[model samples]
Target: MMEKIWQRKTDETIGKPILEVFPELLDQKYPELLNDVLSKGITIRENESIAYIQQKEKLEKFYLDYQYTPLFEKNGTVNGIMITVYDVTNKVEARKKVEVAEQRTRLAIEIAEIATWDLDFLTDNIIYSENLPQIFGQEKGSVITRQKIKRQIHKDDLPVLKKAFGLALQTGIYKYECRIIKPDAEVCWIRVHGKLFFDENKNITKMLGTVLDITDEKNSHQTLMKSEEKFRLLADSMPQHIWTSDPLGNLNYFNKSVYKYTGLFIDDLKEQGWIQIVHPDDQKENINSWMEAVKTGNDFLFEHRFRRYDGEYRWQLSLAIAQKDEYGNIQMWVGTSTDIQDQKNFTDKLEREVSERTAQLELKNRDLINMNIELQSFAYISSHDLQEPLRKIQTFASRLSDLDEQNISAKAKTYLGRIEVSAKRMQTLIQDLLTYSRTNSAERVFVKANLDEIAEEVHSDFYERIEEKKLLSIFTL
Candidate 1:
């Protein structure tokens, strides 16, 4: 380190020969070290004075690497070094921070289309985001309160929503939907999805979220529902008849057209009362058969008579169907009937007219009728015609046996018994054929016959045969 030497404008440099004995004089100038002038120059920084200012940080001394003459007092000149030494580290660091903050603001605006805000809840004062005022519809830059926001919500949806800030204060998070009143008085739905700001103890300070207008989506849903309702209403008012029934073939729906054809309305009919118009004789059988099919989920292909509006009964062919669900429940049924009276009349008339077309046709067909008659006729003919020959043969064989009793062997008797057995077997086959051909021919008319009783009669016949054969036919069912 070296001491600084100050020089006045008019002072001269110290001589080296006197400065050698007292080396401190090397820092002096003029007479008596010219201390007064130099002291004044050092304190006041005069343009006519010179100062050796060491370039060092804090208390350290330094050498000047570069210097130039500096202008001092007015009308005066000073020859000295103007040192240029500066520590610029703090300045550069401060400039860097300013640049980074500017970049962050630019990026945030570009990415999110958002700005910042501050609010004072108790004072009801609001400091908006930079973009907020430009984007607001009717309430730009207005001081907002909890009440003001609540009033903007749609009247219909108002009952469900709470003040966002109040809810945020009580709860840790805030989420909801609301509508806003636009500048043009148009109602707009905005979805606000966000988080609530909190302090260390989880006390909410403010709420923040993103807002989106969703008016288009809500409008679409309402339009679709209205279209669906129109379709359903049109179907209900249609004139074409649509009906469904239970498995028992009950009348579940009688459309307006059906009511117009039949004089009776749906409520006027008792369960299956439509059967009453069936040509009385066909009613029982037609109803019973159709119902039997319904119980088993089978097709109901039946023809019946329906009473028309003109007080006449017309034959109708009804086609019915059933629908079953995954659990096999009869989910639904469908039925429709078509007029078939003309076809039925034509068929009946033709059958009567062609009953006796040929005598040969009658003979072959009549032989297929009446099993009991066929059996009696066979017995009557065989007893008179075949019995004589059979008896004569048996008598002759017996007479021959007696004559050969002393001359014939036992083999001869066995051969005679075999001949009798063969004759009996042929008689049984002829009786069986006649019975099978005539079964059910006598009762050919189709009716609602008592099937259970008919089955019982067949059972009785089997029992009688079993008793005669001494066989017990045990039944488990």
Candidate 2:
């Protein structure tokens, strides 16, 4: 079968040496493999070799994988080599492309400063990327062992790393953030993400992960926490009520003043507890306004009455402003409630005093008005009654004067003239008094009056009486 398969032309061609039949095996590339199989009497051998060989019509280059085994004679001594060939050109090309990809990936990892690691569970060997030294701040070519990496980890973080790794053994996932002391003795934080590989029996076979530097992120968080603590301390030190709420207007923090004024513990004032401290009359309006402000992220200011610890409702001015992020999203509402009870009390007192004084002035005005009306009525009645009596006296005196003076004694006639003159003077005095009363009693057009003109009128009436007196004087002498 072997002779037929090789198509040997004669028995001598079948028993000849391998190189005598296939001379292409004489290349230097396959020298070691040829020695191991043909000269060393090896039991079995394998190798990959390339060669140029004559084909049906042309010479071609071929990549071949060969398996060589020694054939034994009847006496058990090695006789010749038996060979098997397989073409592996495509496999070789694929392997070269894989190597190129790996090179590119390694370059990318270095540029990104990522520290990649693979740990073989069975051998307890950890293979780290070339960039591991840079991440750990270690010198170039420094030895990196599992124990050395463990030593670099902070004492407080070692147990955390171990626990996360242990959990990965069971869960096939791992994540951890820990601090490590760098080669320069400076501490830095790192975050690690890992995936665990399992074998058929559910045993851990390997772990693959990457580490990232996170020192900047860690420091920023610490600073923010410290700033918040300081703000809380300052707010608690104030006497006025201070509070904070989320964007939804749900209260989250209240200062010490809030508890002191309301006489309520923090636990007691969790949800809507602030409403209880507000006076019942003001709660609805206050809550509505606050909700509107929160929905719109606008500032709010209002005054309402709040119940104090002593069960007294006092006026307070409540103001709140929304805290916002750079994107204009509301983060929280910071607010203060200041006492305005004293100012409100003062304003009430002032208003009461003004109202009382206004009432007193109105009462005095009405009394003065009533007195003027009564005085006007009395003046009218007195002027009417006195005019009738004066007319009767003048008429009777005239009639007496008309009685013939021839029939009267001279002394009697003189007395009658004097009586008439006195009656007329009394009438003039009454008219003057009436004019003065009318001036105060009613509205009148006031013209410029000369006192001398008024005196001259009265003097003329008395002058006529004086002439009559002169006549009487003549009779009496």
- Candidate closest to the true structure, highest lDDT: 2
Q: How do the residues 378-434 of candidate 1 rate in per-residue lDDT, one tens digit apiece? A: 766755576566667667767666775668778787666655544554455556554
TM-score of model 2 (CA atoms)? 0.52
Q: Per-prediction TM-score, please?
A: 0.28, 0.52
Clashing pairs in 2: none
RMSD of each: 27.7, 16.1
Q: The CA-based lDDT of model 1 is what?
A: 0.58
Per-candidate local distance difference test: 0.58, 0.81
Candidate 2: residue 19 lDDT (0-100): 73
In model 2, where do residues sit more than 4 Å from their true spots?
A: 1-115, 123-134, 138-145, 162-173, 195-204, 271-273, 307-312, 367-477
